[model samples]
Target: MQKISQKSIHKYLRHDKKFPHVWCPGCSNGIVLGAVIRAIAELDLKKDNIAMVSGIGCSSRMPVYADFNTLHSLHGRAIAYATGVKMYKPEMDVVVITGDGDATAIGGNHFIHAARRNIDLTVILINNYIYGMTGGQYSPTTPHGDKATTTPYGNIDPTFDICKLAIGAGATFVARTSAYHAVETQSFIKQAFKHKGFSLVEIISACPVIYGRLNKKGDAPTMMKQMKDDVIPIKQYEKLSPEQRVNKQTRGIFINDTEKMEYTLAYQELIDSLKVPKGDSNE
Candidate 1:
């Protein structure tokens, strides 16, 4: 029963005073960070036994700020690196943090395969629809026909629903939420950590500096307000008509199926079935 704060996490981290964080103002990355930290604190996970890995992006910088064993890895390979770490050290609570571009653009292959494997890991994907750190390029999550520096005329490219992708790729737990809903976002993250199989929480955050300026989504406050107006709670959504729900928002635990076997356990089962002789130390 520890509170998540600078003092509480200081003992577990390498550097404390050096962090108000380097992320831009009005960024949802901070909220996401707070949610994850809160979740870890709530779970009472040992900092020594937790590993956070990240790829290159604004969101990828998360591991650097977290008070845990961490790896700041190459672009688009956070999940792959995390999977390897978990496979070797199955006791670690491995969390992978990456942006939309880092996760789905260059990292698309790795992302899908990780989901397919159903590895015991929690993936926190912060999807803000543009490359925030690298001058606002259009990303895989960019809405169709939205403007970005790379898509000045209009995007015309389809945006990927990350939660749906994770679910379809075979992740055992999949959920989605916006940075606007801090409480719900934290709740989903906590649940994802508790789930034994591959779990994914696709956080739809607002990037006012990049996405808003380009897509005319307005300022940070405006973008947040849009989320508040658009995201329909699960309870209220259930009461809505089919017509009313069309093209409308719905946010909740979209999928939760724990029956799926995790990769580590499954691989162990395969080895057991093979009956490989235990006598080989180096033979």
Candidate 2:
């Protein structure tokens, strides 16, 4: 593999210094973004060959900040757009970045179908629990009994376990990591990128300004500290009792497996089997 430097990766950054970031200070989205950039740099993937697609929401803003060929698409349609991109230009490294609501709620259908088809795409779901960009509305990943602007009486719905959902949807690779664990998050992103078929990385991020304040999770620092303190390493988790594991454990790498015959590959095989000579007209 070709080696690339951080300086080279920095060149691909799209956000300007003068404008500053739109995200609130201490938000974990910045950390997730940094990890993603590091992963891409480590992989040595060419900037021009990579295409990043995003749906509407705070997380959707990520592609705008990334230096790759970016598309700020409609809400819950990022994966749909990315699927089209990959189907057309199979060589392109297509990535879909979306939020919990964008991926699991309004875009729920697209999410499952993409995984079911095993499209060659990497999906990074940045979940902050609430609709950060549109105030503190409850999202699909919002925990039960959590308070949000729209759920003033506490959220009654059960939250979606994104990793499990991805696995159930037939994703070749599925992993969950919190934003506080930058190293693990980057490593997981690298693994996801390397996985041949559909891959999904559900990153739990801190939204201090919106979700944090609304849910009384304290400031960004406190929320991140909670994550760091609560998240048990996968190795350490193996040693823990079942009850202990239930009490305080944020597991890692929940699922990782390869799938045979990804959608594009299967399509190509079908075409090859047709065996019609090029430029020949069949009667």
Candidate 3:
């Protein structure tokens, strides 16, 4: 028997053409990308069977580097595109790559509807707490007092609890993890892909170039350590009262395997039932 090297996963090298990715040296997008690839490899999915869709942002550029059927669509529309792809090709694995702004700002509506319909797609939302692509603007997930390009004086808006929103909007699987938790993040991605209904893995990534520098959140290591310190696992979160978990960075799966009719299969069943007989029995 011949030996195989799992460490040399082919998909990891798919970014060679665009080597030296656009993200900054300390940015965690690369880490998150690795997690996605590792998850796909572990799932044993063929490149042709997976479709990676991304919106317009630093996180949105993931599709360009992955060796899969990919679509780099407009900002805030990745979920919309992924929804269409899943509807037309229900068997294909569809994963959406979006940033904090792309997922919860302009793309919020699409995100909501996709979860509401229980679309069978995996959404990897990289939340760096700001618009990394667009001049470090305060995003929907930016902390209330964080500073951004637009919020030089400090952001006064409340942040969106991404995993909670996904669960509330009807996603069947919702999990929270950070880029620093590389192995766990990969495992979560695999779980998301394996799930039958809408699944979202909210990844807290580091944006040292923009978000971190603007907000004085320290270098990449410091920011990552912050997440490591603040985030709590799902079981631990469950132990806390509602007031205790308030404004906390909760990690782990919020929902898993909740029975829901997947949108694509439901649609197919509807069409199948609507088919009329070609001829009456008496005819």
Candidate 4:
């Protein structure tokens, strides 16, 4: 891929209309947005050919700032909306931007079923471990014993391994990365766009104002450093002993299956199969 510049990325953003994004001072959503823009620019994709759909959340606010064919739908319905866009115009690249609560909590069914159907949609799930925009509530991916507005003492719920869920749900392309690793995140996004079936890139992001403050995870910089230290590449993580792997997360592609037919393509094939021959007439 050709090298991208900060100035070039501006072309993809609605900076003139949506200046000064709404994310917190130390939030990681900006980093993820940068990665997304860079990925699209690197691919040289036409803005008209891409449909960016998002649900209600801080992350969902991204599409409003982007210059693509965009949709800001209801909470937990980004995937469903994106699916419709993909089905109607299978030639367009549909990207779904969603948050932990928006995607896995209220939208878990949509997320899983999209994977099961193997539709060609790139899902960028930003896992911040808490409901940042709504409140300081604990989310599905919140770590066990973590503090939150709802769990003042500590949360006892076990966290969801997003990558594992996507793989098990049959997403043809599954990968994990953090906001700190901007280059890797962009690379994974590019890969997801190229994949033929359901593609999920779960980006572990930071919500320093809410989740970090409640959990005593320090400021945004500290949280970013923690992300750098806590997550190891999948290849290196595989070499660690069981004990060493504890409390650690792995980054890298978990699966990329090319055999399964994409839902849109399969549906088109079915439509074609039902069509009568050009010269044949059935009385």
Question: Whose lDDT is greatest here?
Answer: 4
Model 1 TM-score is 0.89
List RMSD in Å for every model shown.
3.6, 3.0, 3.0, 1.6
The total of clashing pairs for model 3 equals 0
Q: Write the per-residue lDDT of candidate 1 for residues 1-283, one digit (tens) a residue.
A: 3456756655554575657777888899988988888888889888889999999999999888777899999999999999899998988999999999999999998998999999999999998889999989999878778888889898888878887888889888988888999888888999999998889998888898878887788889999998887777778888988888753466889889989889998988887899967879688
Ranking according to lDDT, highest score first: 4, 3, 1, 2
Overall lDDT per candidate, in order of appearance: 0.87, 0.85, 0.87, 0.92
* Alpha-carbon runs more than 4 Å astray in model 2: 1-8, 15-18, 234-249, 277-283
Which pairs clash inside model 2?
none
Model 4 poorest ten-residue lDDT run: 274-283
- Candidate 3 residue pairs that clash: none
Candidate 2 C-alpha error for residue 49, in Å: 0.6
Candidate with more favorable, higher TM-score: 2 or 3? 3
lDDT of 3 by residue, 1-283 (tens): 1122456555445746776677878888988888888887777888899999999999998777778898999989999999989999999999999988998999999999999999999999999898877788999998888889899899999889998899899999999999888888998999999999999999988898898898788888998887787677877878988898765687898899657899999999999999986778577
Error of 3 at 105 (Å): 0.5
- Candidate 2 lDDT for residue 261: 64
lDDT of 4 at 98: 95
| Per-residue C-alpha lDDT of model 4 across residues 52-144, encoded as one tens digit per residue | 999998999999999999999999999999999999999999999999999899999999999999999999999899999877899899999
Clashes of each: 1, 0, 0, 0
